[model samples]
Target: QKDGTKERYVYACTPDGTVGRCNKISIRCSEVDEEAWKYVKELMKDQNKVEERLAEIEKKLTSNPVDVTPIDNQIAEIERQQRNCAKAMVTAKDDEYMSQLFQQEAHELAKARREAEKLRADVLRGMDDFQLVRSKLDEFRKRWLDHKTKLEEEPTYTDKRLACSILGLKATLYSAGHLPRYKFTITPPEIEFLILLHRAERQPRPWCVSVPAG
Candidate 1:
């Protein structure tokens, strides 16, 4: 079958994506696969995406991009809502009504401030989680690539699954290998899990990797 003979092979691409290739051959020696060109082409398509990303990076380079504008927006909305409360106070013309109005407005402002602060904290936490996830995904990708490379050196091996797994792109791998069986493949519910996880109040002292023995 090596001498220009055709053979059938199934390729599981993305989740719910598939392709079949027969008698594929390469005439040139290459550093990366032909498919890698597609990735490069994808990156080349949009100048706007590049410029937008640059702007986002510049925003991050500034000191503390998070601003009080969200809080300001909430304050404005609350003030509008409390106008009726203010009018009520004016009509009553009693010290008790004035005190009540002040307390109500104070509570509304406090609630808005708290909500904005919580959202800001959540965004910060999400950025940290993204970094952690990228690191972990990189580790997985490296290991998957190494394993796939070893497999390639053998007499027979298909790189279909390996390429996808290398870059955190293996959802279809599970689907192909008897979908009903491995259907429950894991996905990162990072935000949901992080919400449940409470940070330890006390900082744990750093421990040396090895303990010196007497």
Candidate 2:
């Protein structure tokens, strides 16, 4: 509204208030706006130019150019050294010093071979001794197992003998009227009674006669 020029107005509200002020805007383009637009266009063009240059640089970097001339030269030098070494070997084939060196190496190899053979023999002897010991141990184990089996069976044999002796003593004592009439088939309790009777008879004044006249 200033200077009698009609200007467009816009309302803007801020976070600080519910009511906002009407701001005047220019509807006609000004020379400063044109200059600002020109500046923005120029800045966009420069940015685009920078991006194009960066793309060109990236393409060059991705091409991976390499120079192998130094490596080729090193390979050529190595081949030359190998050829020279071959020529030297051919020239030195019949040298007397080389012959002596070869003979000394052969003698050392033979000495080392003899030592290896001696060590192999020692290892073989040790293996043989170990095998022999293993066999003897096996035999001892068999004997010990047999003795253990006999020991395991010994109680049964001893029990049979003890039962026979008890039966025989019971028969004799019953026949002589020193004990009660016995059943033909003796049980464990009868055997125990016979054992007690025998133990008591071994005392003074033979208790067999005083056993209730049974």
| Best candidate (score: lDDT) | 1
**lDDT per model vs. reference:** 0.37, 0.35
Query: Once superposed on the true structure, which residue ranges of model 2 sit more than 4 Å away at CA?
Result: 1-93, 147-214
lDDT of 2 by residue, 33-126 (tens): 2332333234334445434433443343335334445545555554565455556556667997875665565565556546655665655654
Q: What lDDT would candidate 1 get against the real structure?
A: 0.37
Please write out the lDDT profile of model 1 over residues 47-120, one tens digit for every residue: 46433533443343343344556756776776776676567667666688677877677677668757877876
| Candidate 2 TM-score, true structure as reference | 0.26
